[model samples]
Target: MGDKAAGGIPHYYLYGDQEADVELDLLHIEPIRERSGPNDWRIRPHAHPDHMQVLLVKSGGGGIRMEDRQLPIPAPGILVVPAGVVHQIDFDPGTDGFAVTAALGCLRTASAGDPRLATAAGRPAVYPLAGTGLDIPAVIDTFHWLHREFIWSAPGRRTAILAQYMRILVVVLRLSIAHQDAGTATPDRDYDLLVRYRALLEEHFRSQRSLGFFAGELAVTPARLNAACKARSGKTASELLYERIVIEAKRYLVYTESTVAQVAHLTGFDDPAYFNRFFTQRVGISPGAFRKQAARSEG
Candidate 1:
């Protein structure tokens, strides 16, 4: 393992089976830390442009930090972090766990072979893996095999490792579905909402801002949907919906040279004044000022 200091943090690039310094090429797996102390494990916020990771915590507890949200560590569970999601993990300082990371292409190939596996593209994918004891052993076996292949780092090892990774993905999907059927798993309301709502908002946030529009499509009353959202997240359904809209506005303001009126129209606002007030209320800055600041920072 090679120790490289990246931005004041020590990265112990440890590989038990392969030569160290082999940059993360498409897919990789490694043990972050073994059982050590109550607060022994720590990782600063990080983002991977083209990599996704799956974390399996066999024991101990901690928390996972995702974009603007924090999820309590569900020990003995599995976690998936898709690409482009800013995240970090803090385990019971002495916690023991292992994580596997693979490129998006690798995930697709794995999913292509098995209809049971689910593929989440361009979004943070987090799933709990502890409910089905039936599939647990198989998942573990596949996980270890991938890790070993990574460590062995022999010629043409990636092809074999990728195959094993796909097999585990299939087992995990089946186990999750079976657990849901048996009512042993907690309702994945937030995840289900995130996937479905995000897609709807992408298509309709411009023409519709009413919560009722989305609630109706989900076959739940607005109040019911609001409660489910509030239970999973502190935010109400409307608040979450508006948050997504505001986020889009910010992105346009920072990345485009569009005028305020152009931006307002693009984000579904009929009036520039209304859009300005909305943006300022949520972001604490006027759209024009925000754009200028971002430009200056980039420059």
Candidate 2:
């Protein structure tokens, strides 16, 4: 579904097949290309909770900044930005590329090996794929097959196409995991603290939205935690918390048939009215309206 219903953060363009239990979304600068002018192509800081993205550089140059890392892509390189990482991208003039996004549920179910991957959910592992002649072509071919199948094939063929797509991801995953293990080193204290806080938020975003609560769990002062997040992501701790809440709310709104009041409760909002107001202020649309719009587009 190319159409987007506003809410969470970046408006995802969803793609689906009948066989897959979960959908995939690809986001780029195309939706706003005209307003971007000739030299500008960029996606502002945003995150996706349920999907991971693979950015393939077709031509030109750009860079993506995630957490503490700012990687410059001078040539063709495949960049994987995992779900829920506060990240952004900037493109040079005439830059051409396609971002291949996949839902985590589909990926885990599709992939055979690696018990560790299930535990390391929602974090992106960026990789350079172009220089390697062997794996790069296969990965690109698989992505192309998925795109072609999604567009031309009938519903009956969706399952087969989805299976093929999963196979592609397995290869990518193996390469990524191997790279990480080979270069594995202990992260610094700030990185450790950031990871700890993210894990806490994943587990406790429902009942606890307190930065102090997370800080207490991590054995650090709230100010220190805030500084860590700020230094790493350029977003305050409170902003991160709100971003999580909003992402969950968006998932519920799009995937489930939940009422506005029900979604508020599911996402830790006590009052539906306040939730509606907050969502509108942040997303520029009411909860009910957003849901209806997304549903209409998907349908």
Candidate 3:
């Protein structure tokens, strides 16, 4: 019943699936080959809302399609990918480097003083070292040390890992300042609330909870919740939930051999007739038709 398994983006866990270490804040470091080699060197479009990824490219060439921008990943390039940026990475075959994924908001959470570190690290900056004679091997050396620290845990192991991270960030910050390759770094006041709301919405979207219910859970008024959502994502709170439901419905239609009624029931619609109308209005096709179309396309 599925064709290309429609509905939503495919989640690519840069960090291997496992129980993350709490002391390290889920920090993970691996060779880029280990992460992307099996996938034919193509990373699909996805966002890490709860993770920051740093790609250190030593050889080969590729590019990253970040939202509307396509930036080249030169040999000896360093890319700092902040949280919540939808990006797809395509690497030339035989690309060499390391991929580091670390804690959520670790880049932005600063300890007093001038918080420009947050601004510098928060932006999705790219530094191509092919043409520019930037002789900063310290960054590369630190990544290696960080990978070793991640592999073995001894006394001050966590401290060493974070120290390496600091060194890498220091280098990244200097490069960012020199090149001023600061990508769109939007600082939204309600973004934190929106992130919290999105987490809660994922848990209760199937229940079709009202805006007031979400507001109650988040300790905010319904209006404030909707306003925050609108300000951050340009979608109201209810719209986000509706989009999630539609995505789930599409997944069922494409992946499962379920009838339209079953799909509707699973998506929280008790009445099949109303569900048909809701799906049709939003997706411009009936559940049965979508499944059939997907089949045709896949065939």
Question: Best-fitting candidate, measured by lDDT?
Answer: 3
lDDT of 1 by residue, 35-57 (tens): 22322476655544335677777
- Candidate 3: residue pairs that collide: 2-254
Clashing residue pairs for model 2: 82-124
Error of 1 at 140 (Å): 16
Off by over 4 Å in 1: 1-53, 56-78, 81-191
Q: Note each model's CA RMSD in angstroms.
A: 12.3, 8.4, 13.2
* TM-score: model 2 vs. ground truth: 0.57
Which lDDT tens digits does candidate 2 get at residues 79-163? 6666545566787766765555666545555543654444443345555565544466666666666666666747766575657
Listed in order, each prediction's TM-score against the native is: 0.49, 0.57, 0.58
lDDT of 3 by residue, 1-299 (tens): 10111125332334335321121145788988987899899987665544667788988879887656888887788887765455788999999888888754344332123456555566687787544545657667888999999899677896788778776776666677777643433435466687778668767888855988999999999999888766544457887788768777887887799999999999999999998998888778887888999899868
Which candidate ranks first by TM-score, i.e. highest? 3
Provide the overall lDDT of each model, using Cα atoms, as 2-decimal numbers. 0.63, 0.60, 0.71
Measured with C-alpha atoms, the lDDT of residue 174 in candidate 1 is: 57
Q: Could you tell me how far off, in angstroms, the CA of residue 170 lies in candidate 1 after the best superposition?
A: 13
Residue 31 alpha-carbon offset, candidate 3, angstroms: 0.4
Pairwise lDDT winner, candidates 2 and 3: 3
Global lDDT of model 1: 0.63
Report how far off residue 40 is in candidate 2 (Å): 12
